[model samples]
Target: MNTDRFKENFLSFMNGCEFIYSEFKNGDFGDLQRVEVESFNKMGAVEFWSSGWVGIDLVDCVSGTQEISVLLSPEQRDLVDGELRRFADLMARR
Candidate 1:
């Protein structure tokens, strides 16, 4: 997994974004990380896919987001859900 590309894309997506919180994990597949970015009232989860090609998905809190699949390596659906849940939880606490 080329993590350099992933980081590049992540930073691009986070343009003008105010990072609220983030999490990292050393999983069985690879090193997975979740970041919550906010711009004004817009909030979404950015999951750094470590097992596949440098890829990430944007999911709106009120809008249903599409999931991206690159290969049959592994799915980080739980991580995505967890990021959203945790982001909301953290935002609520603030």
Candidate 2:
């Protein structure tokens, strides 16, 4: 995966998604902050985190732990999935 491109385009990976805000969260790093964006339907969320390493999380509107796949179109799901794989690769490299 081309993580460089993924990193550059991460925020706009999904269309119609609105960027919410980033806030600090207590974690292993003690300064982890998550960048959150609401899904287009406002029924889910995509989050990006990079305190000491990169990570991505998809929050289902209900389950919270489930991926936002249920709320996304097939194309949108592919885009998010690809970015997620790239994020995983980047984190592994780190």
| Per-residue lDDT of model 1, residues 1-94, tens digit only | 2334434434453446666445456765466655555653445554555664223444444444433322223454434434433444433332
* Deviation in Å, model 2, residue 44 alpha carbon: 5.8
| lDDT (C-alpha, whole model) for all candidates | 0.45, 0.43
The residue-by-residue lDDT of candidate 2 on 21-90, one tens digit each, is 4556676534444445555323333333333344455544444444423222333535555656543333
Q: Which candidate tops TM-score?
A: 2
Model 1, TM vs. native: 0.39
**How many residue pairs clash (N, CA or C atoms closer than 3 angstroms) in each of the candidate models, in the order given?**
0, 0
Whole-model alpha-carbon lDDT for candidate 2: 0.43
Candidate 1 local distance difference test against the native: 0.45
Q: Any runs in candidate 1 off by more than 4 Å, and if so which? A: 1-15, 20-23, 53-94
